[model samples]
Target: MSLARENRIDLVRGLSLLVIFVDHSNLSFSGALQHSRGFCDAAELFVMMAGMSAALAYHPASGAAGFRATASRTLRRSFKLYWIHLLMLAAVVAAVFLLPFIRDPALVREWSLDKLAAQPVRYAVEAIFLRYLPAELDILPLYMLLIAAVPLFFAAIDVAPRLALAASVALWLLAGIFHLNLVDFSQPKGLWYFNPFSWQLVFVCGLLAGLRVRQGQAPFAFSKPLFILAFVFCLVAIPADLVIHLGEYGETTPLRFLISKTSEGPLRLINALAIVYVVFNLDALQRLSPTGWLRPVFAAGRNSLPIFVLGEILSDIVTVSVFGREGIPLALELLAVFVGVAILLGFALHRDRAKRRRSGKPASSLLVASQPEPDYGPETTTEPPSIPDARPNTAT
Candidate 1:
């Protein structure tokens, strides 16, 4: 089959990164653009896209370099993420500690790291083990763990097309039923905010969808009835889940499991899938113009890891800058959001240009970021695409 690569994933991933910065920046104007308007947020999108990107990057086709080599590379990428997480953790901690202007406790309260300053050594150790998560930073360790498990997921793929998916769902059910989670060091009986046990279900689903893409097919067959149902569900969710009755995970609430972000709540997962289906089936996303208004967005998503790291720092910088202001001006909020996005876009484009330069490839149009690469087999080249390979996460 001729490869029909889709650029929608990059487009959506880039959009999510933008949303993440705006949301985390805590700018008052972010409510309109951030994921708070939905049941699931950018974190969910990034994880699913990460799984899809993993399939593209490390599928057996790429394994012709030798499955051993591929496995080693994937694991190495995981370690690289681990080290980067640590560095980011240190930077975040130091910034919070050393910044004199950030005197307002409320400004830094979201970090939830009151104990960290007192015991840096101990917190560092816990962080190394994927514990002691601070706000906005927990996703890194989760990504690190998931990337490290790619080999196992690929193994299940080899065993049976649906085996991994089945196991993923079963584990998710078990986790929800038993409240399974990795240890959290911040408090007694604490657990990771986004539980990998439950979140794996979505990642595995994305992996399966990507497998279809690798074979030049759409991720899901279109069903008009299903589309209508998903559309209705998403609309209802905005009001029921995000607006009215969007309560916390209160024990007595009927929507307890639905609101629990840690367990990848059932309603939230369904909402995420519903939205994805509606968007993907509409077919508009398939024909996105990479060089159009979203050119910067595509660039940011193409080099997501670096753009993401930069965005987090920028978010904190903005939050700190406005700590004591009586009220955040709309102008500063707008500049923070727009300029932060521009910085990320520039960084992503720079990384893309650097890669093209090093490879001695001619400069590419904006299409370079969204070009669909052929999914090759053994007869095809084993070299991974420079387009954000799950490995060498650096766009280069």
Candidate 2:
């Protein structure tokens, strides 16, 4: 893909991360930004981006060196992701404890640390094992596990691209049918909020799509009728989300349990793919310019790992300290957005500067110097792209 096209992917990733932050906080604008009004949310987009990025970085390695390099890079990234998750977990737990002393005590008893305080050692052990994640923190653990499984996914893809996808789908279906899921140490019977078994299907689809992107073809070649159907389904979701009467119809209702992020229900996966199909088919990136007003978002996407973690921490703080109180001013919400973007931009600048100092070159050159560049020369068919074997090195 062209650099311009990749920038657009970063734009979507950044925007998704931003919206996820808003959704985490109880800000009013969250309703406008949150895709949960439909069947998917920022989590779907984030995971999809991660999978595609991984494939783009590692799938084309040619020999023993490439294979070992890819494996080492992936392992390093998994380690970083796990460490970051632990740090964030500690921060979140601290926030849960600290917020009450500074704000309304009644507001956080359920959402914060009451139960955690009851059994600190057990919960700590669970968090370490990634079996006791709370709401916002759940996604991190899933990403860590998924990163660890990158090698297996690549092995499957090597055998046959379709085989990888088929395996992913089978796992998802079996998980749903047998209720195969990870148990939370905090609650022995509690299932993982974002079940990796099911969500892997979405990631696998993205990985396959990335392979097609390298070959200069669309991932899923849906017919015209299928594309139209997908469009109509997305449109219907807008109203379906607004209508509350559907819930009153009970569990048997067609829409009641149609999709679930927790189990990554089939319908939900279909809905997310439908959106991706439309976006890819239409050259959606053409509409978005990296140098345009959306540059901040693009930067955030480029540095999604730190930005997402920071955004979550900030959003949660706002949720307990500001949103939990009555009548939150619009200015405050807008200020929150500004602050988040500023932090992301500032971090980007710092990273760029530090990279330049290490490389002794222009900051832009250093930005991705660590990554192997993709080789698309005359020997492309025989030699793998030489570009960095490491993905973005960030768990989006």
**Candidate whose TM-score is highest:** 1
Over the stretch 34-81, how does candidate 1's per-residue lDDT look in tens digits? 424466666666777777667766665434455666578777877777
Tell me the tens digit of each residue's lDDT in model 2 across 88-123. Answer: 878767766665654445434534344567788887
- Most accurate candidate by lDDT: 1
**lDDT (C-alpha, whole model) for all candidates:** 0.67, 0.62
| Candidate 2 accuracy as TM-score | 0.81
Q: lDDT value for candidate 2?
A: 0.62
lDDT of 1: 0.67
Shift in Å, residue 279, candidate 1: 2.3
